[model samples]
Target: MKLLLTSAGIMNKSIHDTLVDMLDKPIGESSALCIPTAMYGHPWVGPGVQAWEFIKGDARNPMVNLGWKSVGVLELTALPSINKDRWVSLVQETDVLLVAGGDPLYLCYWMQQSGLADLLPSLRSVYVGMSAGSMVMAPHIGEYFVGWNPPNDSDETLNLVDFAMFPHVDHEMLPHNTMAHAEKWAADIQGPAYAIDDETAIKVIDGAVEVISEGNWKLFSS
Candidate 1:
């Protein structure tokens, strides 16, 4: 699968160009399925509201400027109550999967329940994971410790990728995600860890992994 996992979506022209190249088609002919289910876990709160607004806006200029013709949201939580086959079809037809950041476990639950996990390996779409969305692709979620909620009881994640990703590290806007926190989080993990800021990301195409950054990031081994 082709994945462009970011702390924040499309931070610069270089990343945008890379994504467009990965798509291998004019963005105008493509469709992006934006998943906002992760943000729902934090309803009414400041961070939640911010994520919800991101979904509502769909990173308007970032996506529009890239030339994606159809950018729409597909709430995975609501799929079980509807026609899943059609939903799956839509997922398959999408050229990109724009996943927003929030609760990693909550996002993983819906993904497994909706059967997206099973289908992800074969998906032709470019997977763009923002923050928690990127975290869910790891073997497990680490000490994300953002808003001081109860720790995720289950550490298991989708395991689509091999390493734990610590996103928003040293992020200017999110003072809560400090380099110190990232260091502590990685120290406790058992495998390779990546601390990525908003301007950086971890991109995996097929079996190859590379840090795609316009700003800064660090990879740690345990």
Candidate 2:
């Protein structure tokens, strides 16, 4: 399976060109299963809400514009009570799986509870993860707190990829306090990790990873 773990949208022309080349298929021919599983935090709630509205509004627009025929947007917010069979079916049938940004911890918890953690690695579809989506696919979750009534515990991750990924790297949208928090989390880990700036992505193919972008990519390994 081809995986694109990006920090944010495909804002870079070079990255977009590479992504288009890697897929090797017209955008309209591919279908996507969008799992907005990571947007469980306040920082993403508003933007997620707005983006979701666009996805659902004219399915034809995003789909056609992006070179896909269908887009399945799953409502993963109601976690631990999700339908496993249905979720699995969506993941199984899609040409690509697009995971949006949010809180990594929340995304991990839901994926575990929903049994998706066990099923993703074996899937043959393209896995596209952004921000928190990228974080949950790592060995551990990055520290990005959501200011909720009571902060949720940092959950165990899917471990599909060996290293932890920090998205929105060097982006002005990322808060200063959040950066310090993430750094502490990175320091606590005993293995390699990566921090990807907005529009940059890391693609893992045949067990080898290549950084794809027009900007800088950072890595930390002990």
Candidate 3:
């Protein structure tokens, strides 16, 4: 699967261009499934209006509002109770998966329980993740980002990527997510990591990693 991991959503033209490049098509021609599963697990975010905004593409950052050929909600929490055949083909047919920000661990839990984690390796769609959604692709989110504890009680995530990420670095709204804070988090992570602001995104294709940024980002080697 192609990965376009963003601190925020596709917030700038550079990121937007990269996403289109990854898709190899115009935004209007693509089909997308927006996953709002992570929002419900976050203490500060959802089970309310925020989740609605993201689905409606009226949130602070872009994702679902990109004017795709079609946009559907694929709530991970709902998948376990339903038959896999009902949704598996739908997922396989989609052009992209738009994962929203919230608690990465919580999202990881549902992704596992819903069977999506296992299916990821077979997907042809581009996976576009915002904040925690992007962070969850890493081996670990580190202790600072842990909010909704998983059943295993680990800060570990999907391990889809070799490095961890500290997102929203130095954003005015999230004052605590500074570069210094990211450094501290990286020390505990003890691995390759990135500190990225809203305008930065990491693109991964065939195991190669590239940082595309209009704002600021730093890579800390393990």
Candidate 4:
């Protein structure tokens, strides 16, 4: 699987062009699935209008609005009730997966529960993650980012990548998301980590990692 992990969605031209490059096809010709399960688990977001906005592509982050040929919902919470063959084919056939942001642990739990975590390795789809959606790809989100708790009470996530991330760094609205705070968070993480602003994205292809940014980002080496 290919990854274009963003602090926000495609918020700038560079990230947009990079996404298009990763697709190897025009955005209008591709099919996508938006996963809104993470929003439901977050207190600030919800099982309300925020989730609707993301699915409808009306959210602050530009995701589903990228003009895919077709866009559908792949709610991880709903997959467990249905048979595997039903949605697995849908996921494999899709060109990309637009995963929304909310709470990292919440998204991680559902991914594991719905078997999406297990299925991700075999799929060819490009993963486009926003905020917490991107954070969940790491081995650990660190204690600071843990909102909705999993049953085992671990801060651990999917381990899809080798590093951790701190999103929305220094945003005016989020006073606690400063670079200093991120440094403190990274101390507990004790591994490679990145603190990124909204205009930054981390791209991964064939195990090679690259920083695609129009804004600022800092990589804290392990």
lDDT of each: 0.78, 0.66, 0.94, 0.94
lDDT tens readout by residue for model 3, 72-96: 9999999999999999999999999
Q: Write the per-residue lDDT of candidate 4 for residues 17-133, one digit (tens) a residue.
A: 999999999999999999998999899989898999999996479999988999999999989999999999999999999999999999999999999999898889999999999
Q: Model 4, which residues run further than 4 Å from truth?
A: none
Q: For every model shown, what is its TM-score relative to the native structure?
A: 0.89, 0.80, 0.98, 0.98
39-99: candidate 2 lDDT, tens digit per residue: 6554645444545653453232122136567877765665357666656777777787777
Which runs of model 1 end up more than 4 angstroms from their true locations? Answer: 43-52, 58-65, 146-152
Q: Which 10 residues in a row give candidate 4 its minimum summed lDDT?
A: 58-67
* TM accuracy, model 2: 0.80
Candidate 4 lDDT for residue 180: 96
Supply the TM-score for candidate 1.
0.89
Give the range of the ten consecutive residues with the poorest summed lDDT in model 2. Answer: 56-65
| lDDT of candidate 1 at residue 1, scale 0 to 100 | 72
